[model samples]
Target: MTGLRPDTGRQAGTMLIVFGVVLLVSSLVVSAALAPSVGAAGNDGTPQTLVGSQGGGPGLHESGSVYLLDGKETKWKAAETDSYFDVTMLDNGSVATGFMDSGYEDCEPYESPCTHTGFRILEPTDDGGAEIVYEYSFPVRTRSNSEVHDVELLDSGEFLVSDMEYERIFTVKNGEVTWQWNASSMYDAPADPTTTDWLHINDVDALSEDRYLVSVRNANQLVVIERGEGVVEVINKDENGDGTGDPEVLLQQHNPQWLNNGSVLVADSHNDRIVELHRNNTTDEWEVAWAVYEAEGVPFSWPRDADRLANGNTLITDSLNQRVVEVNESGMTVWSYKTPYVPYEAERLPEGETVGATTYAVNEDATVYGNGDVPVLSLLLILFQTGIQVPFWFTELHVGVTLVSLTMTIAGTVLIVRDR
Candidate 1:
C-alpha cells in the first residue's frame, strides 16, 4: 500500500519549492555576469534603473526644458523636414541647429524640394515659440555639393555648416553661403575614398576665420583644412622638398570640438575616448596638446558627441551605453545618467554651467520596474546563475540569455535610480 500510493501533498510541495529556488538562482547569476561592466551616472555604486523613454524632452544634467530633435521628428517642431544633426547656442541667446529639410523654403525664397539644404538657425520668440531667423542655403551658380551636418553662429548672423556628404564646408551670413570650403579639392578622391561603410565625413569645428578642424571617420583622421575664397588649402603632408608641414598623419578620431583656450576636443569613437589637442589650434600652427579617454577608468561603450564645459568639466554622450557622463578635469565622474536609450549628442547649458555642463540623457527607467519586495542584488545574482537564458524568454543562445540578464538587472537598477 505504501509503495503504490497516490502522489502525496508533501512531495508536491517539495517539488514546487525546488523549482522556484532553481529558477530564481539562475536568473540572478545571468544578470550579474552581463551587467554593464561600468556603472552609469548618478548610479552611486549601485545598479540603478534606466528611466524615461528615448527621445523624451527633459533635462538630465540641468534645469529647464530641452529636447533633442533626432532628425526623425524635427518637422513636427517647425524646423520642418530636415533631420537634425548638430545644435549650438548662439551668443545672442538663440539656438543654432544643423539639419537637412527636403522642401526647404529658403531665405532668398529659392524653391521647394531643395534637396538636402543646409543648417537652420532658430531664434527664441517672445511667446516661447521659435522663429527660423536664418536658413543657410547655397548661392545660385555656386559649385558645391548638398547636405550639411553642423552649425555654429559665426557672429550675430554668420555661421559655419559642415556639408559632410558633398565634402564641402559652407560659410553663411544672413541666410546665404558667402564662402565655401571644398573638401574634395584637398583629397585625391574628395575624402580618401569612402570606407566600405560609406562615409568619411564627420564633425567640423572652427579654429579661426581662415582655418578649421575636420573629422573624417572612415579615414580615421583629423586634419586642418584652410579655407580661402576660390581655394581650399590642405596641409596633408610636408612630403616633397620642404619642412613646411606634418603629413596629416592618422590621428584616430571621429569628432573634434573647440575650446576657448585654443585647445581641440576630439571624440575617439572606436577607442571609446575623447582627446584634447592644443598648441596650433586657434589659427594656423596647430598641433595636438594632450589626450583624454573615457573619463579615467569609465570606458564608454560607444561615445559620440562631447563638449568642454566652462567649469573645467567634459560632458560626454556615451551613445551605446545609453548615458551622458560628466567628468571634472581631475577625471572624476561628477555626474552620470544611464538613460534608457541612445543619446547621440550632449551639450552643457550655460545658464546651468554653475553646475557644470547641461545634458539631456534619454532615460527609459520604468519599462520593467521592480517592486521593493525583491532584493536588487539577489534579483541580479539569480538572472545570471546558469550563465544561460532563464527560459522564460524562449531563447537558447548564451548571448541572448546574457541580454535577458541585462534586462533584469536594469529592472532592479531603476529601483535605486531616484535615490542616486
Candidate 2:
C-alpha cells in the first residue's frame, strides 16, 4: 500500500505537468491566431481596409480635415488653437464652426456678463486652408461654450443656433434674431444660483420652415416647438408627473434629428444608446421603433450624435470611446473611425459637398484603428464565427486550458524570481 501511494503521487504530479504543457500549447495557438490579425489590422502608417463594406465613398480621407469639435483643452492646444464647439459642413462645400475665445471659461476681467462666443464660415482655398468669408459673434451667459451645441445654415441665408444658458433657441439673420423661442418656463431651474445651465439644450434641428426639434438634456426630453405655438410634442415626457422626469425614456440625450418619415432619431446619451422615436399613426404617441445599443457586442459610451446615412446605416459618434462607428440596419458595425480627439459629432456630407482643405493629422500612437482601407469588422467576424461553430465542450476545454496555462506561466515566473 505504501509503495502504491508514492506511485499515485508521482502520477498525479505528472498529470498536472502534462496538463500545464497542453494548456501552454493551446494558449500559444490561440495567441498566434488572433495576435497577428489584430496587429495587422492597425493603421501602422498605412491605410486600413474598409470595414463593413457599405460602399460609402472613400471612407475618411487619409489626410483630410474633418469639421470636428476638439473637446479637450490640452489636445486642442496641441492640434489647433482655434478650438471649436460645433462644426458643420455646409451644402456649398464650406464649413461652419462655433468658437469661443476663452473656451468655456468664466467671463472674468471683461466686466461684462457675457463671454465671447461666435460662429465662422470658412470657404476652402486652393492651398488646403480655409478662407473665412463670414463671421458673427454673440454673448452667452454660461461659462461653458457648450451653450451652443449646433449651428445650421438654412437655405434662406439664416442661421439656427441653440442657446442653453437662457434655455432658448433663436435664429440669426443679418446679425439679428429673426425668430426666437424661450423654453425657460418649460423646465425647472436648479436650486443653486451658480448652476446657470439648467435645461442644457444641446441640439436644435430645423424640422420645417416653421417648426424645430430641440434636445433638452437635463429635462430628459426632446421638445418639438413650432415658431408661433409653444411646445407641440414632447418625446420621453414626464408622463408620471413625478417632477424628476420619472421613467425617462431618454436620459440626458443630445442631437435629436428629424427623419423624412416624420419620426425622430436621437442620441440617447446618458442611456448609452441610439433610439428612433416613431410617432404612432393611431395613438399619436411616440414609440421606440429602432435602437442600436451594442452593435456586434461593442457598446457605446457617451455617444453625442448619430446621423442616418443615405444608405440607411447609422453613423454614430461614440464620444467617450474616442471613435465613430457606422452600424448597419442589422446592428452590425460595418465601419468605424478612431479619432485622436474626443469627437462630439459626426455627419456624412452629401455626395458632392466637402468640408474644405483643413486636414487634421491622425495620431499613429493610438491603438484603435479605422477609417482607412483595412476591414477590421471582418476579422472580428472571423473570431465570432469560430466561437459559434466550435463545439461547446471543445470551447470550454480551450478556455480552461488557456486559464491553466496563464496560471502556470505566472507561477513559474514568480518561482524563478523568488529563487534568485
Candidate 3:
C-alpha cells in the first residue's frame, strides 16, 4: 500500500503485543477474583477434592451412606427403601428410619384412601443385613398423601413423628397414639385440598423431658410445644398472631435443635442459611445469636440439618449442594464430604460407632446438582471482573494504543481467514 510503508510491519507487531498483553492481564484478574470462592477445608484454607469413600475425618453417618476415616473401617448400608425420609443411629447401636408411601400419584388409583406412612427400628447384623426389631405404620387422618419426614424414639419408649399432609405431630407408644397435636386449625385451609400440604412439618426434636421443638416448614416457624400443653412458644412468627402473616426470621425451615446455651439452632432452608436464635431475657424476643450462610467461599443451599459437634464444630448437611461440611465457630470449613446423591441429613457418629461392613450405593438418578457444580456466584464474579477491566483499558491506555490494538486484532483475524 503506497509502495508498502516501511514502518507498517513494526507498528502492527507492537499493536498485537499490546492486545495479547491486555487479554492476558484480564484473564489473570478474572482467575484471581474467582479462585478463593472454590470450596476448601481446614483453618489453613487448603482446597480439598471430596471423595465418596471411607477414611478421612470423623465419619458422616447419613441416610444413604456412611463416610469414615479409618482404613480398616466397617460400613453397612442398605439399598433405597420405600418412602425413605430420616435415618439415625440409636444409642443402642441400632438404626431408626421413617418411611411414608404416599404422594399425588400414589393416591391416583384410590380416591378416598391412600397408602400409609411408617417407621422402623432395625439392628444391623454382622453380615450387613439389618433385622427389623420394631416397626409401626399409620394412616393419614385425611384421605390425602400424608408423609412422615422425621421420626425420633422417645426415652419413654414412644415415637415422635411428623405427618406432613396432616400437619400434625403424633406421639405413639405401643403402636397406639398416646397424644397428638393438630396444626390444621392454625392456618386457613388451602384452596386446593387435593394437592396442598398446608404446614409441611418436617422435623421434630425433643428439647427436654416435657418440651419438643417442631419445624413447620411451610408455616416458616419453629414451635416449642410442651408435651401436653400444645404450643408454648412460637419462634419466627409474626408478633401479631396472624397465621398468614410473614415470618419474622425463618423461611421454609427444617431441623431445629435446642443448644445447651439456651439457644435454638435451626436450618433456615429456603433462606439458604443456618441460624442460632437466643431468647433475649430483657426484650423477651428471639434474637439471632449466630449464623452461617456463605463462609470461606463455600455456600449452603437448602441445608436441612446442622448439628453442633462435641468439638465445637458444626456439621451441616448442605442438602441441595449434595455435600456435607463441618465448620468451626468462625464458619471455616474443617472437613467436607461430597455425596453422589442428595443427602437430607448428616450426623457425626461417636468415636467407636461404625456402620458395619457395607457400601451403600448412591442413587445416581436422584442426584441434584447445586452450588458444587458451576458455581453461579463465581461466574458472576468473573463477568464483573471483565466488565471492570474493559473501562480500565479504554481509559487508562493511550487512545492511539487502544484503537491500534483493537484494529490489529480484527486485521489478524481477517488475515488468518484469508490465508485459510
List per-candidate RMSD values in Å.
Answer: 14.4, 12.9, 13.0
lDDT, candidate 2, at 63: 23
lDDT of each: 0.47, 0.56, 0.58
* Number of the top lDDT candidate: 3
Question: What is the overall TM-score of model 3 with all chains considered together?
Answer: 0.63
Q: Could you give candidate 1's per-residue lDDT for residues 1-420 as a string of tens digits?
A: 344234344444445445545555586566555554343444343221111111312111111122432221221132234244456665676666655444434424335434444666666565544677766554221211234556665544467777655565667775556887665554445233222222346566766666667665554555566654433433223445342233232233544665533445666565545655444433554443433455424345446676766656677776545566777654567666654334446565543112122221112111111111211123333333222212222222443445555555554444334223
Backbone atom clashes (below 3 Å) for every candidate? 43, 8, 6
Tens-digit per-residue lDDT, 1-420, candidate 2: 334443454455455556678776766576556531111111332221111110111211112233422221111111232334456766676766655443443455344555555566767566544566886765555435234666778777789888775567888988898988877556655654235656777778777767788887887888888878979878776776754343335778877777744467778776668877666677766666666675434455557787777666677776545466667766767666555445566665442112111111111221212221211223333232222322112233465565676676556555444434
Ranking by lDDT: 3, 2, 1
C-alpha lDDT (0 to 100) for residue 251 of candidate 3? 76
If the candidates were sorted by their TM-score against the true structure, best first, what order would they fall in? 3, 2, 1
lDDT score, candidate 1: 0.47
Query: TM-score of predicted model 2?
Result: 0.62
Q: Candidate 1 vs candidate 3: which has greater lDDT?
A: 3
